[model samples]
Target: FFGDYPREMREMLSSNLPKFTSEEKRLLQNKADFIGVNHYTAIYAKDCISSPCDIKTYEGNAMVQAVGERDGVAIGRPTAFHGYYDVPEGMELIVRYVNQRYKNTPVYITENG
Candidate 1:
């Protein structure tokens, strides 16, 4: 994940994403002992590439349009934060996803709301 950008990110951002030199790539190999995950909630992601969107959202850089609702239904219980939602299951999903991606790297839930 360090030598080159992930395929999805590359596809979305292309040249906007940075490239690493040989020295940087060597330093990144087997470097991390763990991964810190800060998961709050999961939002529905619409492909902005296929649909109209402002393309100025937090996820716009990923070519994804994120929304808290679908078919006028909220994804989960609302939280104090405007966009953050109360979705406990999301935490497990996120941790599991990270574990799979990092492959044996210890994952810590550094923050949750």
Candidate 2:
């Protein structure tokens, strides 16, 4: 992984994201041997910055809304948990995302259900 946060994230968060010092950047770069991921479900994300949304969700600070459904259709079969869903494709998508983002670091599925 790179030393600092992703460029797009920094741009989106602006001053909200902390600045990394030269030493910090050096220390943080490529620090992880492998990436551990816990994937359960995936849902739609709605940009809240340019649109009106109920910002009460956990991702409120990120200026995005986590949506379980779009156009009144559920993203996948619902689980007993309120927000979580049974989306098979989410696992593959998440793994690919981590691989691409972290430069193909060895990944372990630390926790999944």
- Residues 2-101 of candidate 1 have per-residue lDDT tens digits of 5666778878788677787898877877678788887778798877888876667553465777899888999899888898788889989888888887
Q: State every prediction's TM-score relative to the real structure.
A: 0.81, 0.86
lDDT of all predictions, in order shown?
0.79, 0.86
lDDT of 2 by residue, 18-44 (tens): 888999999998889899999888899
Model 2 residue runs over 4 Å out of place are: 57-60
* Alpha carbon lDDT at 44, candidate 1: 83
Off by over 4 Å in 1: 57-62
* TM-score for predicted model 1 compared with the true structure: 0.81
